[model samples]
Target: MPETILQIPVAKIIPHTLEKHGHVRTDNYYWLNQRENPEVIDYLNRENDYYQQSTAHTKEFQKDLFEEMKARIKEDDESVPYFYNGYYYITRFEKGKDYPIHSRKKGSLEAKEEILFDCNEMAKGHTYFNLSGLSISEDNTMAAFGIDTVSRRQYTIQVKNLVSGEILAVKLENTTGGSTWASDNKTLFYSRKDEVTLRADKIYKHKIGTAADKDTLVYFEKDETFDVSVYKSKSKRYLIINSSSTLTTEYQTVLSATPDAKFKVFQKRTRGLEYSMSHFGDHFYIVTNKDKATNFKLMKTPEEATSKENWVDVIAHRDDVLLEDIDIFKDYLVVTERFNGLNHIRIMPWSGKGEYYLPFDSETYMAYTTTNLDFDTEILRYGYQSLATPASVIDFNMKTKEKNVLKEQEVLGGKFDKNNYKEERIWATAKDGTKVPISMVYRKENTKNGNNPLLLYAYGSYGVTMDCHFSSVRLSLLDRGFIYAIAHIRGGEDLGREWYENGKLLKKKNTFTDFIDCSQFVIDEKYTSTEHLYAEGGSAGGLLMGAIINMAPNLYKGVVAQVPFVDVVTTMLDETIPLTTGEYDEWGNPNVKKYYNYMLSYSPYDNVVAQAYPNLYISTGLHDSQVQYWEPAKWVAKLRILKTNNNQLYLDTNMDAGHGGASGRFEAIKEIAKEYSFLLDLEGIKK
Candidate 1:
């Protein structure tokens, strides 16, 4: 078959000059920003068509890849049931179903089952549906959950009478898709976002059998920088309203038993201070960065006195370790900590005796606490996984120190063997003599020092650490002699808080450089070269992908960016866009001249110049609330005009989804298949 050449999309140029900080930028593709304009819709559809036509040769291959990946998954599967509040909740999927069925059994796992909500049924007749925040009333006779028919993430709150199996007449719209139930069982507190900015600003209290208009506005956050949310304390003693900005946090509390009581602030917000609280028997445990504890520490305050002055150190600050989270029990305090690069769960008795760490064999692995709902029990349930190991749920007896494997994810088809793969943690040297960590995995037979096709990935923003976790989809690459690696660069909390602090704001360039440095380090060490290397990330990580490709165009043969945030300066300056205002702390406010110039230096859309570029595959969702779809559309339009190379550049815009491409479990697999095939086709790999 003769190859069919694709006609590149030429977006109509409408000059829009954005003047800020005594500077002016004339955007040629700015007309694409008119989302409601039919021209904009037509242009996006045309681009999608071009992408499909360009990759038409791989249509059959993509289907095969999707099927191969889907086969590894257990078709009829049920998660490990966790007991919570007099019920054992379990989520299961039937063989051909696209969504999970949420159900519960009373008292014991063998007891009669009661279905909460079958998502497969609820998701029917809708292109996108998401159900979240399923909060059961304290009496266990009612349930309140949030649902979204559109992909914009704005959900409507729905109530159901569990005993009667009837949905109530009450409905609340524009919610954040979460609700906290009070001890009264009939009262619920939910958070709603600003209609325009989508900033979660208002928390409301709703009583059963009342219209949403009558719901009381319990609290309203005046600060645009801070977002608010509500949740019940683990002890169920308090309903906590947490308001947090990028750098600071403030928490208000109301007795869960007294739903109508006024909430009181535990501690006033202080700039640069961040803290989160959990309640135990007589005190509140605070994980905070108070007193310049860069890596954070645990402190305790009497239940009666929660002011900052009353807080005393329970766990002292450590310079080398980052305290991630803590789980309190009747006799044990299990702290999830990060030292070096791997996660560690350290178990300590309340009596301060017999302190130990749960041992993990993998050099690079993740282990964290799961739903340990009952504080009176000695058993701790946690999830554990690594690059080579499948996810496993374990129940550990704190007293006897016996660990029982409750469930290890079954990679169906009987073809997977743990012994055939090898995983390792390696360090890549950065420019300033700092050692960045990288977690790598490959089939044991392909581990020899050779220039193999390697996919290096990282998300270096928002203090979000990318851990070494197993993925059944990744096995497809591994089996094809491709090494998968995760770069634990700065901006991520993988190493410690200091690691994140150094890669953000004025020092944000470290993130881009760290990734480039890792790329060069891996290639120098003979893992892969520029000819065989590939890179991938999504959302904020997509921002990482955009920046790195501009900084080092020759670093990889191809790059995959999903729902990328490419137009930084323009997006940040416009506060009307969703998620733009709250992220000023992550990517500095471009309104200020200094930050404007800094962001402009690396803004991918602005940095596209007349130069040779690598093969590129970019994707976005038309309804993405996080990064507006037009950002990627405008970027591709500009790249088509300036890029000097003819290397393949394909853009896929999923019209049926939002920030997340697809809602169905199997449907999402097909998106991954498209991405994997793009990489494999470039490398000339075939089954």
Candidate 2:
């Protein structure tokens, strides 16, 4: 079939000039930010039409790819049931259902199943639906849940009578999609979002039967750089309100038993101090970066004296190991630590008895504690997975050292074998003599001759580590002779706290450079070449995609930037945006001249020039709250006018979705199928 010739979308330029710190920038497509304007909507619709017409030839192939990927999943699946609060909670899906069925059984698995929420039925009438923050009262008779139908993440809180299966009359609007219930059952605390900025700034107390307008504002966060949230402690004794920025945190707490009691400050906020607290018997366990503990440490203080002055070190700081988190049990204290870019769980008893680490065989795999809600249990449930292996939920007895595998993800279709694939961890040398790790997997039959198609992915921001884990959808590429790899570069807490510190603020260029170096290293090692290499990332990682293409346009054959935050300087300057003010510590505050100059030097939208760029497939959601839809739309507009070569640049916008495309299980697979079809079509592959 002959390809359809489609007209490229041309956005109208309204010339908006922004100035700060004695500098000026003129934006031509800035008018696209007017989302409600008819012309802006028309432009987006036209781009969607162009994308559909351009890829029309792959319609059948995309379907086939979608089916091929979806067939590997078990349509009827249930999560491992975890016992908590006298019930075994389970989330399962029917064979043809699009959403999960949240259910539970009292006492044992053989007991009668009680359905709490059938999301499939709840999502029937809405184009987009999300149910979050399902919190049950201590008596287990009532439940509070948050619902969002617009996909903007401003959820409405509602209560439900589990015994009668009836929704309550009260509705709380503009909430953060979660609530914490006090022991009284009638009182709940939730964070409210600013209607304009969508920042959770106020914590409110709402009674079960009262109107939302009548709810009491318990606490309001005055600092624009911080957001507030409320939650109950693991011990269920205290209701804690936390206000935090990227580098600092302050907490206030009150007894959960007394819903009307005033909350007292646990610790006053310091400029750079960060700490998180957990309650046990008589003291509060705190993980903090006090006294210049870069990687953080564990401390404890009496319940009455919650100030920093009363805190004494329980577990001292280690220079090489990052203390990620700690979980308390009746007799054992579990510590999640990261060493050499790998996760380790250290089990220590309260009596200072024998302490040891869990044994893991894989060189590149992800392991972490999962769903241990009961505080008196000796069984530690943890999850484990690698590039080739499926995810497994295991229960380990901390005393007897016995391990039982409760469930391992069943990959249907009977064509998968763990032994048929090879997984490895390789290091790449960066420009500053630093070694960066890369986790990759490929079919054993594929040889490294610099001719294989490789998709390299990374998300280097906010100290979020991208661990190596299994993916059934990725099998479509692996089975077709593609090598998939993850770049554990700077800007992530992969190696240690120092790794993230060096990749943000004035040193943010290290993230882009590290990725570029990893690409070159793979090419030098004959894993893949520039002609067949691809790059992918979303959100802040999408920012990485934009930066790399502007810096080294010749490194990738094609790049996929999903909901990318490309307009760094412009977005950072607008505090009204959802995450701008709160992320000042992550991406430096652009209002300052020093940060403004540094940010502008590498901001992707500002760096576009007349160059021969690689093929690009960009995607965005019209209702995305994190990275606004206009950023990608404006970027594509700018790239269209300046790029010297026409190498298949397509922009796909999901009008019905947000940051995450499609809410259904099968519907999400179709989006991935479209992305895979793009890559496969570029490789001249068709089923």
Candidate 3:
């Protein structure tokens, strides 16, 4: 091909005006939203073809990059087996296989393995496939799993008999893809999403060897803003149904033995009151934000009387800590807490005796509880990793307080050394006088220099804290003298709930500004310069990337947005889209004038104007159910028309994937390789 083909696809303008809350706006590329239109498909394919042609020279570099990353990973790796009930379950991958093989050994890990599912075999004859929600029956004779072939998050559940080694004829369609088997093993409960909205609205009960059409509706959520799910409690005594929204939650439950029994309400849904439940002994433990516990507190109530009035404080709320999650065992209670932007696991005796936090030496390490299925076990299994460290599985004995390393991730076929890398946690002052934490890592040999290339990443939304975790793929950058930093800005619960609160809604711009400030901090500290810095994020984080570039287009040298939700105003206005209704609390109801104006202010597509823009790389999936592919498609088209710079802007649309790029392990790495090649090529680092 030519040195570089800059032929950009221009999507025909078909102006569609929308008036909401007395506000008038015109969208010329709105016609791209028609998924069934052949022209839309053609336009997207052309963009993909254009991207491929533009980067065709880097094909060899992309392949080498992929191989370099894949070589760091152990292809024939197996996850640490954990004992559950009477079996030791494990998932392993064959050396060249794209999918995992789930297997179990009866009684002990040394026993002969019984294969439960080979995803590679199951994934055959499909362009995209996802296997989730594997729930085995109480007796362990049968298993139920959810499979999605279309990448829309809609699943079809199937049951398999372990004894006969046959997938039974029992199939349930239009389900969330995993069934909760009652104590009887024959009774199952599963959730189903709406056909259009794709919201998990109704849950149904099914019996083994029965037709799906004859399944009985067990519970239905009438509110469009809430989605419901069903699962068996950890204690296996009760089948719990949970309905939740962005800011609130409600729970109901029935005995696992009685599938036909009516579910009694455990707690009524109170606006802004969000809580999760776990059953143990004779009580239901609740992690809730009740009584103005903004960081959340632990409360417990008798199993029979699960109302809010009966709740008694178990762990009082703390101002400095955020209770992220909990794992219960017969003898111990493991609490995953985030304090001072670090994850700490506190192991407490179920009898309320001595409690202590697991020790981690790194300043920016991530530690959390892993699978601990045995209720009577004294050992607690967890995971710990940092930017300079590979992920390690650990087992700590509660009684002795001694810990043993079970498995540390092996980075194969490379002269890798943890001491060769340096990681630091530094604070960057935000525009509002808030200190935003930035975790960064680079090669020890690489000194701080303004000319060094840097990639800054962040996902500051939904109160989801971005913990600094290790990535083998990141080695490709670090080995190339590139700095990788994570801007744990506002909208994430990294600091506290207030940190997230301050960064969302009317303050949503804080997320964007905080990221920009972090970039400036690194620049001021001589880590990198504006000319060598690149910003990246995905989904909502993609929104962040869009906003940052708009606010300061000259700040970044390049940018990548994956499955970005850039068209915020128009998307939030349409309630039919998946997750739009449930996210009103996160982004606010744009039907209100204030929110509408605020959203439109930063909506990427709406803000695209005639200006000098940064080199851009954008990607999306045609079958994406979360953020529709058209959002990025339209944004790129508008940018192509309006951008006043000769900088390259490319869009790669995955023809056979959804929200997540690709289903297979190796297939997903290709996307990463392509992205790395884009940035490396810009920095002239091609091998």
User: Candidate 3's residue-wise lDDT over 528-586, tens digit each?
Assistant: 99889999999999999999888999989999999999999999999999889999999
For candidate 3, the TM-score is 0.99
Off by over 4 Å in 2: 1-4
- Cα shift from native, residue 263, model 1 (Å): 0.3
Compared with the true structure, the alpha-carbon lDDT of candidate 2 equals 0.94
Q: How do the residues 381-475 of candidate 2 rate in per-residue lDDT, one tens digit apiece?
A: 99999999999999999999999999999898999998999999999999999999999999999898999999999999999999989999999
C-alpha lDDT of residue 228 in model 1: 98
**For every model shown, what is its TM-score relative to the native structure?**
0.99, 0.99, 0.99
lDDT of 1: 0.92
Tens-place lDDT per residue, model 1, 119-228, is: 99999899988889988887889889999987899999999899999999889999999998999898999999999988999999999988889999999999898999
lDDT of 3: 0.92
Clashing pairs in 1: none
Name model 3 segments beyond 4 Å from true.
Answer: 1-6
- RMSD to the true structure for each prediction, in A, is 1.2, 1.1, 1.3
Q: What is the C-alpha lDDT of each candidate?
A: 0.92, 0.94, 0.92
